[model samples]
Target: MHENVRTLLDTLELEKLEENLFRGTSPDNGWQRVFGGQVVAQALVAAQNTVAQDRHVHSLHGYFIRPGDPTIPIVYEVARLRDGGSFTTRVVTGIQHGEAIFTLSASFQRPEKGLEHQATMPKVPGPDDIIGQEELTTRILESAPDAVRHYWMRPRPIEFRPVSFEHYLTGDKLPPAQNVWVRCLSDIGDDPKLNAAVLAYLSDMTLLDTSLFAHGMSIFDRRVQAASLDHAMWFHRPFRVSEWLLYTQDSPSSSGGRGLTRGSLFSADGTLVASVAQEGLIRLRQKSQPDV
Candidate 1:
């Protein structure tokens, strides 16, 4: 396992507080708190720890409280909500500083035959044809707004390859639609569930940025303030996230200082493995003028 993946697995091994209660430590990072997806994915893992192996999580809904404290350990309290013949449900509350930092309700279902249909993946260049997000970030920071560049051009977990090299760092503020091909940086084994969870973690990283595109604002711009509020995801098919997955995202509406974004994750061969939706706080911050 990669070091980061190992850190994640260790964090999910919640310390037993009491029967059905546990506490999880935050990874040692400099973020204001735990990354939103980390808590969501970990909570789901914790919930799954108590269930049968045959059951796989198919859906999840989560809300972020105060940003999590990476310096502090999170306490997770699991509720055995329902256990039936073919379906199981669990609710996990992540607590830090005696307050609920995050909470998730996840549902798992055993494999079953069902009707199947999925929207075809959009036509896009293959991964090898596009530049990675890190490389693009470095290239764009040369002329980008300093504030935006300094904040967004930092290191990250996974590498992203947009189908076409356009609008990423150009400060062009293009349309609200974005199709990026992404995959893990390290060989993260062949486990489908782990891949799904990793995808879930990455999905929360940038969906909101799509909502800001049409407004002529970049996430790097000082006048823009964006953060995810609620996130929900649906698993559509079984696939490995270690390989290429197309994340097509769009913003349907933005108003009242908020925006809603939706996206679907598809395998390189056009299998829609997951769908995601999220709403975020899109309030603009006070502008800081650039040096003349």
Candidate 2:
């Protein structure tokens, strides 16, 4: 495993506190707020740890209640909502400093054959045709804003190979759409729940950015204040993090300071593995008055 992925797996291995509680800590990456993805993934891990191994996560609905504090540890409390012959449900609440910071409800199911169908994957350049992470980061940083560059240069559990960097390369107010090829930098063994948690982590990576494409802005844009409000995901088929997956995303609407975006993940062989949707608060900041 790559050092970064190893660090992430270590972060996900929550420490059991009570029968239904676990504690998780963040790596000292120097961010004031914890990455939303990490908390989602860790909460999923905590919930799965409390359930039978035969069940695999099929869907999750989550809400980000408050910004997480990276310097402090988070406590995840899991409640068993239901247990059926084939399906199980769990609700996980992430608490920090005695307040709820995030929450998720995940439903799991045993393996069973079923009729399946999916939309055809969009035709796009494959991973081999895209610029690798090191080169892409170097290219973008030449003119990227401080926040964007900082995020790109940092060592992450996965590497993003965007289909195109046109929007960032130039401040173009293009359509609200994006395509990026992504995968974990390394393997974390063959634990199915682990894979699901990792997927949950990745699902939050760029959905908000896509929502900003139409407005010609980004999370890096100092004039914009953006944060996820809620996130939802559904697992349709088995997937692996060690292999490339295409994340095709687009924003259908952005108005009233809230934007909604959706995406689908397809394996290299064109099987749709999962789907994700999120809405975020994307308020434009009022420009500061010029100093007198």
The prediction achieving the highest TM-score against the true structure is 2
Provide the clashing-pair count of each candidate structure. Answer: 2, 0
Please give the distance, in angstroms, between residue 118's alpha carbon in candidate 2 and its true position after superposition: 0.6
Query: What TM-score goes with each of the models?
Result: 0.89, 0.96
Q: What is the C-alpha lDDT profile of model 2 across 14-42, one tens digit per residue?
A: 99998999999999988889998999999
- Over 21-55, each residue of candidate 1 has an lDDT whose tens digit, in order, gives 77777776677757888888778777877778888
247 in model 2: Cα distance from truth in Å?
0.6
Candidate 2: misplaced stretches above 4 Å?
A: 287-292
Cα misplacement distance, residue 74 of candidate 2 (Å): 0.5
What's model 2's TM-score?
0.96
Question: lDDT (0-100) at residue 123 of candidate 1?
Answer: 87
lDDT for position 116 in model 2: 76
RMSD list, candidates in order: 4.0, 3.0
Candidate 2: residue 25 Cα off by (Å): 0.6
What TM-score does candidate 1 reach? Answer: 0.89
